[model samples]
Target: MANYLLKRGNLWWVQRKFPVDVKDQLGTFFRKSLSTEDADAARLAVPQRMREFDALIGQVRMARDEGDLFANADEQPALDQMLVRYQGQVLSGLSNAAQRRHLRVLEAFGAFVGLNLTAQQLASRAKPVVEQWLLPSFGHTDAGRRALNVLIAFYDWVVECGYAQPPNAFSGYRIRPIKSVVVSRKAWTDNECELVLTSLLAEAERPANVLARDNAWRLAWVVLLGLSSGDTLHFVCEAQRQTHFKALSADWHKTRACWPEIDPYWVPGLSPGGPDGRRSWQLQKALGRRLTSLPGSLTYTGLRHAAANQVRPDFDAWLARLQAIDLSPAQA
Candidate 1:
């Protein structure tokens, strides 16, 4: 039915000329055989062929819009030489870490453009290529802004050193700020808590790696301390023996909040002071990584909230009852 459909002897075919704008990239005409002499069958296939033609045109147009439809040939030594000069001139005094960070961004751009362009050619393509790169690569996050900032600085140096002309391509481009989402720290449900604990205990028994086994065993005890006595990961990590109370205790370093006394649960091959005297936050990260493989979104901090939710209306009575329970190291 479409004008693009035609008959070549016995076999039917579809053909259409590409739009003038995209003709160079996509060629003059798109032609394909329908592989059928039956007119009714060809008619039914026409719609699908037309859809394919539309899709090809759409892709070429999008690439053109992004200024990447044409492939540019490699220009020798210009971009690399300029980057070398930039390091010596602008980045000389910066720390090694800062220098590496800036250079990494420039190298990424070089890689994106196939390492094939003069400074002038790169500058000309910078605007569209950067806009395309930023949206899909980093979106509106701070990392995107940081990368843009790095490029803007690089281009400013390029212009200043006469590698490219005035009007910096990367200058004045700002990714829209990301909208802040307030995450609610809701407590895990009873069944969810039970599931996570069961999974962690099971992992502790037969983890494929030593690190996984150690983290799983420690996390099981950590979750139990939080669920039983509202003990935070930090408190549990830094807990010390209290001779008078005949149990372990720790004070919250930030708020100076005292934790309810509870007996220590030790796992084999792990110290309460952490591996090689690692800090509480370090241990929390190790344990958190282990939790990620389990079902549901569970957090170390959320366990404290779960404990608060469970022991409502009578805190002292709940603590007393929890302390009365005979918890052995093997139970963990």
Candidate 2:
């Protein structure tokens, strides 16, 4: 149904069905590249010219001898492959991330922080809306800003993979710069930690809200074990379980912990919970399931701040101990 195609090398070719009147214009485009053959030309000159122009002159000559493009086209299947990979692989990959993973993280964050979004419809629109409709309204103070940084990293990955154009759709935006605050702070005070743990335990005991209740109680886990370095909720959930499964979210948040040789996440419950291992391993059990959202509280990043301040021996010594680390006060 198309009138013409600029086959691989940018030369335009008219379809066999093109009208006689339209062929004059098409002929102007096709014949412009033609040149008189020179006796002095090397053997490679003809093929090189053909490759540069992407002309189907041989097929045209054959058509004169017989019929059109030999009644078949060669470049069509290759173009179909390009279109298929672009949609099925690249676009599907990015859209799935925005839908299942990015949207869920945004929801969990908004719920915990008592915030709302511009509208889901706005997020579904073009690039410009992210800042106007999405980012500014998220209320990303220091910790929230860092979380936004993680999303920015995802957009960067999309560009690097060539799914996006150069320069990235989400680049150049800034968040709260959590670094300056991290060093002077510690995760939580003894009282605050106790409050969180107790609140979580009580939450877990409730009959309904099983998911929220369980995660709230176990939220201090990696911090308790000195692993507060990261939390891609779903990946961390999967890593703790140590099994193979199709990832629900985009591949961006995956940790090396899933690959034990690289990731050093604390896999709790080599035995069970409690020092003696007789009590319930509720934290371990909750962590094993697929989480709809991560358990976070706007009040909780104070724990991270507190932990950073409490780092003894010095920042360098503390940095050396952790396998993975992020923003600190000096960098802020």
> Top model by lDDT, which number?
1
Give the per-residue lDDT digits (tens) of candidate 2, residues 225-318: 2324333333343354334333422221232232223332333223345664532345445433322122333233454455556622232322
> Candidate 2, 117: how far from true, in Å?
35
User: On a 0 to 100 scale, what is the lDDT of residue 257 in model 2?
Assistant: 32
Best-matching candidate per TM-score: 1
- Model 1 poorest 10 in a row by lDDT: 251-260
What lDDT score belongs to each candidate, Candidate 1 first? 0.64, 0.38
Q: What is the lDDT of residue 186 in candidate 1?
A: 57
Root-mean-square deviation (CA) per prediction:
19.9, 22.1
Q: How do the residues 1-332 of candidate 1 rate in per-residue lDDT, one tens digit apiece?
A: 46888999999999887654445677878898999999889889988988898898778655544552113333234676666556655664466567778878888887777565777788778777767775678788888889889888988987776667788878868776697632226577777676776676667656766566556655665666567667766655555433121343432121111122233322223343545563465667776776676666667666677778883223243334333333333332
Candidate 1 Cα outliers beyond 4 Å, as residue runs? 1-77, 114-116, 131-141, 161-166, 176-191, 197-225, 233-290, 308-332
